[model samples]
Target: MPPIFRAPRYLGASAIAGRGALPYLACVITHARWTSQRWFASVLIAMVVLIAVATVVGAEMLSRTTEVSNRLNDRIAPARTAVAELTAAVVGQETGVRGYVLSGEQQFLDPYAQGRGDETRLVAQLRGLLEGHSDALADLDAVERRMASWRETAAEPLVRARRSDSYNVALVTQSKEAFDDVREPLAGLDSKLAALRAEGRADLNDSRRLRNTAFAGLVVALLVLIASIAVLLRVVVLRPLNELSAEVRRVAGGDFDHRVAPRGPADLAVLAADVEAMRGKLADSLAASRQQAAELHRSNADLEQFAYVASHDLQEPLRKVASFCQMLQRRYAGQLDDRAQQYIGFAVDGATRMQQLINDLLAFSRIGRMYDDREPVDLDEVVGRVEDTLALAIEETGAEIVRPKLPTVPGDATLMTQLWQNLLGNAIKFRRPDVPPRVTVTVTEDAEKYTFAVADNGIGIDAEFADKIFVIFQRLHPRDVYSGTGIGLAICKKIVEHHGGQIRLDTSYTDGARIEFSLTK
Candidate 1:
């Protein structure tokens, strides 16, 4: 099937982030010329693509921020604290050495021993903290060398000289100058750790800002997309629908002349056009139906007048001719020649047949029109009456009639009786030579109706003549041979149709003639 809505082709997988996607979508939206499906798809695809990209970017930024925060809190901060404590430990060692040299107190050596222990532990811990950091580890190595050299050459010598009572001022000055070398490296290490902490905090702040900006932009884009969809729907779907609905209402409110103009998307426009076409057809049909109803009313009036004439005027003349011919026949039976007798017989037969034709025609026309006294007509009783009416024919033909226990149906008793009578009489009349006819009436029922089949074992009708046998006056054999006006099946057709049913020949029944019909249950 052809595509109906014809949404934009760019709203596909390959076009999710295609360069032309946004431009084309924007153009259509700006021009207000898109179908609902196209606009919806375009907007939806744009939203999904942008949101996906934003989410991925935001996640990366968030991860970066978390890494930076961890470095600042765990590595950089702890390394700075260790450097500061190491600087304080070296200062304590210098102070203790100077105090011991000045006063020769043994207790002043305690701070020197404690500071040495702190320096060793701090150097190891800081080395671990700055293991992978080349610049920080270089600065930490320099600080450790300076502190260890100061402890071995300056601090240890000063403590020993003060303990031996030979600590001079020059020696104290030399120790203080050596301690300044340790301070210099410690300061450089402290400065390097401080720079690292500052850089980590800056990276963390930048990552957080970027992540927040990405999320905010995504939210804003979502709001814009939703608003755009709403606007597009209002312009492309809702307005047209409202207009179409109004037009439909106008047409339905007895304004058949109102034309439904096409609007909106291609699908909606097609729908509107179809509705308009239907309206035109309905209007034309209504006018034609009214005209035909009027003609039919006139035709029915003429038919009633014709029926009156055929019943009274035509029947009277026919009876007179038949009666006068019989009288002449009785009077001049031996006097007239055989040719004259034959001519007279022909006239009488023609008049009698003409009367039959008129009666049959009148009966056919009067069905369902003359009366409507519908009731539950027992088909079994109707068949029994028909059998009684054709009792002499049945006896002579020795026809066997097999019938099931029939059900009651809704119809006029007289019409139902005529229906069976005509069918049964035809079966009896059409018997094969020297063959006793066998007729079976069977019934099957369903939810809505009962189907009946009347099958007769006689000269079966050909499949080609199945439709022809039901037409009025359409006889297959000569009048003398079949003895019917050929209106029997036609009358049956009318009677069945009048009762809201259908009758047709069962051509598949090759062994005999079969008639199947259905009636509403």
Candidate 2:
């Protein structure tokens, strides 16, 4: 590598750490243009860019380190070994030549012969390994030149003289000097190879360090990214969402005037505006409903007052007319003609029927209107009172009232008694001719509620008129057939409903009419 381009070859951990995103993030977060979408998107893109850069740089560093390691293993180390082998070969040649000269034996020439071949092969191998390395090649060339000079000027001459008994001490000393020349270059060549190996290892170490620092930076950046995302969500969404939810809950808790004001984004603010508008509408509707309820309560009070006053006022005139007519019938019994007696009779009957109508009307109107009594009323006792009230009818019609031991219910005792009397009286009144009425009163229970079923074996009400029967003044039978104001079932319905119960005719009961009603425990 050129020195000019290798200025920052090994940027250390601090270089990577210094370029971290914290400073940039602080600037970005405080920017007015940094919104939720932009914050997340920019951070995500930055993260992806960081990861890609780290991956590419790490891979390049690993490849470069591997290349240098391979050079040390496959080139520099082998070249060094070749250089060492060449040096050993040179020493062997010097020793073999000296030994052959001293002993004047031809067998002593073997190592010299073998050493020349080894040295030639090693030089060629080292040249091949150090092909692109000028320093190593220059060292190899010096060693080769010196070895050739020794082979020509010392080794050959010494061996030749030993064969002829012409080798002298002066010639041996000159040959030894030539051998030192070869040894010097061999040492230089070995040192040069070692330097190359050391450089390759150093390059490998630097690459590994750079790669490690890059990956560390990536890890730190990942953590920073996660923290940034959390901050963005907390600031942009979660906190605002919590505030909005609290405002909505407050409005729902009957603080209808608490305005919903949302922050953060335009979309969220628009949604809050919609909610506030709805709250306004709801508040207006609530106020209107309260006004109507107060008006309805006053109207109901006025109607109750009118009903109480009207019944009392009308009862007096009907009673006096009825009384005077009865007196007339008794006093003029012989003097009066048949038509006159019938006229008096009609007057008395009309007055009596009018009085009965007014009484039934008063009773029906009083139900669920004036009473505030709530007590545990023994229904069995209520049924007993109803039986006594209808004793004459029950005995005349020979009706059988079968009942279980009824459970006590929370309600007005008078209202409950009236309920039973109306139901039982209807059963007895509407009995089939020549068929004794059989009324069964039974109570069934469920979780948190009781269902009381009063069934009667009599002329049952028609399915079509089942709903109409419970309406005030609604009668299915003619006036001549069923003689009473038709408000009994309506009163029973009002009583049951006032106690938070429901009363309905069981159309499924084929044997007779069954009135089913429910009361919560």
Candidate 3:
């Protein structure tokens, strides 16, 4: 046999690998898409969650800041009023002392007492209001110090003058100068407190701006992520898989010549390569098988032609020798000696056997030439015809032919007739002398082929020669014991083989010989 061209195995493996990889890659891609979608969705959800959190936090912070600012603003005004009240009280005390000293009126003394009391209470309240803040506290301390200096240097001196009876008018002027000297410091302290409040408001505004900017950035980033994921899925997963699917459809349609173009990632590229290799190998294998079949057909035709010409040419010489030998025996048998007659008889028998061999060769060649014309042939009718032809031999041997119902097969009528004749003849010829020949013909059919069996109770062949008996010119018996052209079984083999079928023999000492053949249905 030609080296079993391991190409099919390689192609089969490649095809299997290619087909298997496609689904694997598809599963991978599907999982990737689902996972990627989930990831994108999760990121978006996380972003939204963060945005919500940030929004809530920012709103709370802004609300709190606004509330604090409003509270600060409200406190600033109250603090400013307190400072103004304290300043007014200090100024009034100075004016009252100056008036008492310069106008010599006791009524101004009441004003001084009222101013001192109010100034003391206003300074205490201002200090309480500024308690928590060092900056505000420093401003309050400056105002307090300035008021104390004004009371000591201006109010007390003017009051002393009024009590001393010297009543100097210069003292009243000196007290007014002292009040003006303290006014600048108290105003500077109030200005510093206002600046601090302004800085706090600026910080709160900056915080709100930062929160808005962060939220906007988060939204943009999430949108970009979603868009990127969509693009990735389309490019990497969906498009490549669609291409693979199209290639698979083409292959299914019997276009094994098409090659898949490599695309996508590493695994998909490998799959495409495998598919291409499979197509190449399959095409090569199919081409080789076609060439092999064509060569085999040519060989068979040549053998059949040779067999027909050779057998026809051989028959003419054998016929002349047999006819001449028989004529000599009939014309001169009495004059000839026993030895001469025996030699002449031997020539006749040899010639006759040679003629039979040539005829068997012709029949064997005809078996190969016969083609299935596919007309219905009733096998039962064929068997009956064979029985009629072999009637004399059957009666002589007392052979009993048992034929079961045989199916009608699509076959050539003449070839099937010849087939039954040869098998039935073999059955009668090889029978045991004491036991009557019992021959049985049966048939069975399956979806694709039909089997026919011809069984006989005869002197069976040895197991060793069973297969050899179907070869041309192969014989198992001596000429004296049994006579045959040795091509009968070979012809049967050829006929079965020509019909895309096979033949075999079953033999045993007790059961005799059974010939079985199968033909395509």
Candidate 4:
């Protein structure tokens, strides 16, 4: 409370607040560096790397297996088939040679000619197939030598002897021995080629099995990687967002007292800190608002007290002045000049009006004072009573008050009655000279409030004076034309507002003045 401390106290408080925020500020700094964006990028990069590595390994394994299978199917199997065909060709040639030697006919030599061409083609194919296998190629070369020697020594001799008419049994016996030699080497080569085919088939099966295993392993690895990424994303991103959403809902529900705690990833923590800062500002603003409201309430109470005192204490003096002026007017009317009489009349009228003004001001000031019990007051009853209170005016002006059955609402009954009385009286008082005053009071109910409209076929208030008409002492017409303290609408406004509702002129009514008000039900 000392002078020097008081001025600089706020500075110390602000320093303390800044210090309090340092932890959150540090958290924000850490959050930016360790952001969720970085986390997602890392996961994505790792996934891509894993996929690349797996793809490379799988592709390599598949390539090697495919190559082995292709070698067995395309090269080794076809080579064995070629070797078998070569053996068959040699046998066919020897059979044709024997037929020609036994029958001494040239027609039997036709098979030998065809077999010779087939034998050459088969040998060439076998050599090409065995190119990479040195052991197999050596066997193929020995078979080829035997085939050439047999063709030179047996087949050519038999065919020439049969065609020249010099073929004999002795020549036939030599051809048989040559064919026997050829058959022995051809049989050996066939056996070796069969074994190679068997080995190739076995290797092909193994290669296929290995390829299937690698493919299955690759698929499983991909599934596991996808699952891990999904779990990581849910834990690192989705769960944090869900928690932040819940905290946001709590703050929106007006629980500003409970600060949101930092949660999940660094980014979420930063968001929570920012929300907490906003909550702090809102709490401070609310506190300041409450303080200002308290000050305003006190000021209104003081003003009300002043108005009450002035109205109550000054009434007797105003009454005496009015009474003396009336007495002077009645007792010495002829003795006074016309100007003196007019001055006296002015004083009397002024005092009476002043008294009326004070009374009206007091009534206006007393609105919203919680002295009476608030209970459910039926509008039907309130309107009925207000009608009776203005029965004389209604009769004089022939005003028709068409009011429907209305709902009951909560309010001080006397105040509700006064509110209706003032509205109905004004409607009758402000009737247009050309038209007979017609008033309609209707009620509409909603869940929270009842809207009661009092419309009259009278001289309606202009749109420009709609707001001004509710102000105290604000009149649209001269006092001589429409007699009133000009506090009727203002009093109605206060009463409606005191009951936690609003009263306004319905500008949509073009035929006449329509005043609408609401009361909580």
lDDT of 1 by residue, 1-521 (tens): 23223245647755633333433433343344455677689989999999899988988998899899988888888888888888888888888878788888888888888998998999899988887888888888887888778878888888888778887788777877888887777778788888888888788888988888889999999999999989989977899899999999999998987777667875566667667777878878888998999999999999999999999999999999999998999999999999999999999999999999999999999998895568999988889989999999999989999998899999889989889999898888888889999999999999888999999988889999989988998989998888868899999999998888999999889878999989876
- The lDDT of each candidate is 0.84, 0.81, 0.75, 0.80
Q: How many backbone clashes does candidate 3 have?
A: 0
The alpha-carbon lDDT assigned to residue 155 of candidate 2 equals 82
lDDT of 2 at 248: 96
Which residue pairs does candidate 3 place in steric collision?
none
- Superposing every Cα of model 3 onto the true structure, what RMSD results? 13.7
Candidate number with greatest lDDT: 1
**TM-scores across all candidates?**
0.72, 0.80, 0.51, 0.75
TM-score: the better of candidates 3 and 4: 4
The candidate 1 region of ten consecutive residues with least summed lDDT is 16-25
Show model 4 residue runs off by greater than 4 Å: 1-32, 52-65, 102-108, 127-135, 158-210, 242-257, 261-263, 296-381, 403-416, 432-435, 440-453, 457-463, 477-482, 495-512, 516-521
Model 4 accuracy (lDDT, Cα) = 0.80
Candidate 3 local lDDT, residue 318? 82
lDDT of 2 by residue, 23-98 (tens): 3322332342344566678889988998898889889888988888888898998888887788888788888888
The TM-score between candidate 4 and the true structure equals 0.75
- Number of clashing pairs per prediction, in order: 0, 0, 0, 0
